[model samples]
Target: MSHDARVFLREFLRDPARVAAVAPSGRRLSQVLAGAVPRRGVALELGPGTGAVTDHIRHREPRRHLAVEVNPRLARLVARQWPDVEVVCADAAELGPVLDAWGAARVDAVVSSLPWALMPEAQQRTIMTAVQAALTDDGCFTTYAYVHALWMPPARRLPRLLRTAFTHVAVSPVVWANVPPAVVYRARAPRRDVRAD
Candidate 1:
């Protein structure tokens, strides 16, 4: 679980915007996200710093669990804590090759803990494209953003981007327990017929 806290603390100190939160996500937020998990199948987690949310996700009973952590230290921590999970030290934008390395054609669900508001538009577009391509026919992609930042131009544009990439997107109730609070985004891959348009 990397309960030591130093993992996230060090990362937060290194890059405030990248780390996003000062502390690991609280349990309430984790529960809210874990609840939205697919019934059963391979699930991918992005930026699982310290595996706080990953810990909660483990209980959701996914047949296969994979986590992509850009930081090697944090990735090692997650792998050590969750022996069954496949942890990769690579950028989320490289999901295609990473999934290929994992021998997964597509995943049923994707959960992200990335700081979308802080990313450049180009980087965001790249990662979003990778996410869309990595998902299976019935796959869904999920991520969260702080409620306070919802008004920011970049944050405001996130939902709009999701709508363009997915057939369905919905925002869940705010998890008040999280510092500064946050809301989850639940998005489903566009149906083949819908994508044809």
Candidate 2:
């Protein structure tokens, strides 16, 4: 694990109240996020943990990325890991300010590895709201949940909640090649005409 990932795991395992920030063990989710994202537009990432997803984002395209991490230590680590990436130390709920600071009026996509299942419903709603507002009309949001006990019904509530705010949403399984298998959720902003008005 990377330094930031180790720190995140230690903090998360020590206190459930603190947000969990484990890195994506494999690149499956990252691949999906890259594939779903646009080529030359800005991308936003929440709880990047240690640049695991950032690495993929860099490799896939030349577009700029803004990675928001609440953990200051992790933010510094990510800065070191990806010198070209803009690592900001801020909460996902306050994404608007971060995007503004980056001069990014609208994001092409939002990819995250935040532990949505562990957060309160209200916080979840807030983060989702911020993400939707920051993304363009046709932007996308992608995230993943562990495939173990973490993949229960309650865990699925995030994707369901996303549907209410987005016109297109999907969940795909990323089998056990990871330390634990995972499922990725991709959500797109509502378009005025999906079936053509």
Q: Rate the local accuracy (lDDT) of all candidates.
A: 0.82, 0.73
Compared with the true structure, what per-residue lDDT tens digits does model 2 show for residues 76-179?
Answer: 98898888788899988787777888888888888887778777777787787778777788888888787764655557678667777788888886656665
Which stretches of model 2 miss by more than 4 angstroms? 1-8, 11-24, 150-154, 191-197
Q: Write the per-residue lDDT of candidate 1 for residues 22-49, one digit (tens) a residue.
A: 7888898877776656766788999989
Clashing pairs in 2: none
Q: Predict model 1's lDDT versus the native.
A: 0.82
Candidate 1 ranges with C-alpha deviation above 4 Å: 1-3, 191-197
Backbone clash total, candidate 2: 0
In terms of TM-score, which candidate is strongest?
A: 1
